[model samples]
Target: MPAVTSAPADSQRPDTKPRRRVGRPAAAVLDQDGITAAALQLIQKSGYDGFTMAALARTLNVAPSALYNHVSSKRDVLVLVQDHLTSLVDVSAFESEPWERAVRDWAWSYRDVFSKHTPLIPVIAVLPVTDAPKTLAMYEAVSAGFSRAGFPQERIISAIVAFESFIFGSAYDVTAPADIFDSGSMAATTPHFTSAVARLAEQGFESQADVAFSLGLKALIAGLGGFRA
Candidate 1:
């Protein structure tokens, strides 16, 4: 008869319980959607830097290690938040519309998404796109809309890039805090800015903000068409 061999510490230890499943342990008992939702709430309430994995774990009543079971890092959470925002955009908004309307609607939707998550605006701009399906799907739909709008393939892609750049740039400027314009110095500092503000009255621009968006968007579309023609 062969001698009986002792089990390893994990197996032989009576205090240790049997493993629950074959896969990796979950970070939390709740599902991934729940975690992602919680993360959004946290960011909305406290801003990005204010939130931490430890704090999230405390809120979820799980060990911090468990969070890694669902998210790889804070960067991963940021990506998920961006993905969630993009998913909220209505792709149907682009369907059955003329090229200009479809493209404009898409630009407005992109602007709205960024505006809603102002804190994440920079992050979205910088986040590396690694097979992000929702983001890619939005782009593909916009591209298809442009194609149907009679734009050549190159122009279609160019139109999408130009549209996105305009949207992000415009939203960032509009949403930036007003203190940036509050310096007391006149000709001594930012003379060009002072001159620009002075010209605002002469230009009879009652609402520069609204006018800028409309003018920029129209010009972008016109430029795209001109590029192809």
Candidate 2:
């Protein structure tokens, strides 16, 4: 037989370039943690108006369909974001501390977590907890503490809702300017309000938000504590 010339070594070598996937992955490369992290970072940089499935996919170097494999819609991603953020709140306090102390720790932690992520508050506020296991878990922990303290069954959800409304709105307050209460040119006409603001400044605190938060949180705990049996 005629000698067969050996093919060029380079020609026989396998292509080094990555092969394009022909079908769905054997295991999904995207998971909720990865998607939620990317979505959080993207939202922080772009704001909610600019956040989209396409934008998130681009951030992860994948196609939008890849995200759909993990999350059904933008709302699903928002639920993930809310749940992840809630996981950072100090629910551990509910387990170890007295109810009042636990409430303080949890409230402050929740406010701090979302203060940095106020942009997500609108979506988080509306996202249902039915699908957010982690978020629901936080509620469960808090609710258990409430029940332990003899909080009425019918009032638990309502009470938690009241705390959350205060906490979420406080997150926005954290972003307000130090002089947000200043009447400016109208200060002369609003002497009582201006004087109150001036006296608050005289307290030597570094942050107006901190003062208001402390006052509001104290009031909430007192009001809600009455419901505890």
Candidate 3:
């Protein structure tokens, strides 16, 4: 028999150059634009809690580990999505405008964005809005408007805070669950609840609430004038 001496494992192996893992690696897809777009779509459709690594992986047709190479976690994705959305706010677009008009425009723009991202409202409500770059841009824009009008630093900050708070609070109110307002159970048991319901029925609660919100916001803006004192 020919000396079929067992060849070494290495010798038996085909000597073809080890196939360089050719083609774009998974890391290639994790760039800022791709990830940010995916995150924004997810946010717009399902909100923050609905986003997951698995969903993102499926969206990009990559492994979950691939995302970690770009973003640390879903929270990081959320932050990026927020920053991208915030960047659309162009304060300079309203530049050289009157201070009150600038402030009102800024406030309305902020309100519109937050309302669209209702799920993000709570996240934005608590997170320091100044942390994001676009948010900072908006801050600078508002600050510039206030500064130009001779408003002090503290007042500028306060006005920004109050405007955001009012808008967010109203958005929450409109979106709050009806179960939360179920006075039926209490109305039957509590005299205070009963009286309040009677008054609400007589007063046209919905109209009153709408009027109150409008007046309240106007009052808030007027109160900012006091900031100059």
Q: TM-score of every model?
A: 0.70, 0.86, 0.67
Which pairs of residues collide in candidate 3? Answer: none
Q: 2 or 3: which has the higher TM-score? A: 2
Name the regions of candidate 1 deviating beyond 4 angstroms: 1-29, 178-183, 187-208
- Candidates ranked by lDDT, best first? 2, 1, 3
Q: Write the per-residue lDDT of candidate 1 for residues 37-151, one digit (tens) a residue.
A: 8787787788878789987777777888878888888777777777788887766656887666766777777787777677777678768767577877877787777676677
> Which candidate's TM-score is highest?
2
Q: Global lDDT of each model?
A: 0.73, 0.90, 0.70
TM-score of 2: 0.86
Instruction: Judging by lDDT, tell me the better candidate of 2 and 3.
Output: 2
Write model 2 residue lDDT over 59-160, tens digit each, in one string.
988888878888888988898888899999988988888888999899999999999999999988877888788898998999999999889999898999
State the displacement of the C-alpha of residue 98, model 1, in Å, after optimal TM-score superposition. Answer: 1.2
The lowest-lDDT stretch of 10 consecutive residues in candidate 1 is 178-187
Residue 182, model 3, lDDT? 52
Model 3: runs farther than 4 Å from truth? 1-28, 128-131, 173-213
Compose the digit string of candidate 3's lDDT tens values, residues 1-229. 7877776698677877977687877455568779888876776787777778888877777788888889887767767777876776556634787766676666656655665667777776666654467767767777887888778876777777787788777655555553454577667678877686566667756644344456777787788867664
Model 1 TM? 0.70
Ranking by TM-score: 2, 1, 3
